[model samples]
Target: MCQDVIFHEIYSAGLLGEISLGLKRDTVEGLLGEPQDISVSSTPYILNYGSLQLSFSSNDPHATLQSIHLYFDEIVEFPHGLQLEGWLPNKSVSAEEFLIHAEHFNVVLEEDEQHTFKNPQIGFKSKADVIVVFTIEEESVKLYSIHLGKRPR
Candidate 1:
């Protein structure tokens, strides 16, 4: 089955997408249909929607959703194709522009040694969980592949 894309929207208030935090597995299925595969090993349960992946916490007895990661040429939005305070993803420019946009929204980001930028506060449903990462290259940033989830304890 052809699955519709889950646009990752960075809003001034929070994130909006096909798969986000605090959703039940069934709700996710209702949103994106049955996933191509599911992983429930020793690690957190994962629902793979092609390139996009939704990771749920093991502690969730009801299987509440915890995180969302998008890669493999996924599209992002600020929820329903709206811009976040006039900030939107621009594919025409370099990745630096993306960083600038994030800064414009006053998003607090922490850059790792590998040059990856993460704003844990941006895309999580649980207040205690945060782990969204943006991959930046030498000349541009790859918005197609982003990570949204809780930090592992």
Candidate 2:
């Protein structure tokens, strides 16, 4: 579990702004207006209505948001192709659904592009995969990302 979590209104809208900065929910609302949907779990509650999916942690501060900040998984290259192991979307949306919602997406080509994952983890991959990155646009926000390719095997 995350040790320190803070909630501010602006952090939500300001995530991509500074990346070096933090966001607050109120400021997000002020900029983006309102959330389209909200998903809550044991620890994090995600606010999704626009291009941004903001997740708020419900933990204490000695470990603020940065304390447990998760580093993005790197793309690893296999012998014949590249592998995609971990990628997070901030929601439970399926790869297919996500593909449809993406304004633009691209794949990182591999040699054979025929590598098979032994198992496809719920949100992460058990094996490597084709890299994908998508950009989605919303009223006051846009999601810029690098993602894993999820085309049919």
The CA root-mean-square deviation of candidate 1, after full C-alpha superposition on the true structure, stands at 8.3
What is the lDDT, from 0 to 100, of the residue 126 in candidate 2? 17
Q: Write the per-residue lDDT of candidate 1 for residues 1-153, one digit (tens) a residue.
A: 322122224323225444457778677666676677788563588877656577776534468777766553434322222122433343343445555654554454444434333532112221322233344445444444455554456
* Superposition error at 126 for model 1 (Å): 15
Q: After best superposition, candidate 2 residue 131: deviation in angstroms?
A: 9.4
Roughly what TM-score does model 2 have, to 2 decimal places?
0.30
Top of the candidates by lDDT: 1
Candidate 1 Cα misplacement greater than 4 A, ranges: 1-12, 40-42, 58-61, 72-93, 104-144, 151-153
lDDT of 2 at 149: 25
Which candidate gets the maximum TM-score versus the true structure? 1
Q: Model 2: which ten-residue window has the lowest total lDDT?
A: 3-12
Clashes per candidate (backbone, < 3 Å): 5, 19
Q: How far off is residue 148 in model 2, in Å? A: 14
Candidate 1 collision pairs: 8-76, 8-77, 9-77, 9-78, 95-141
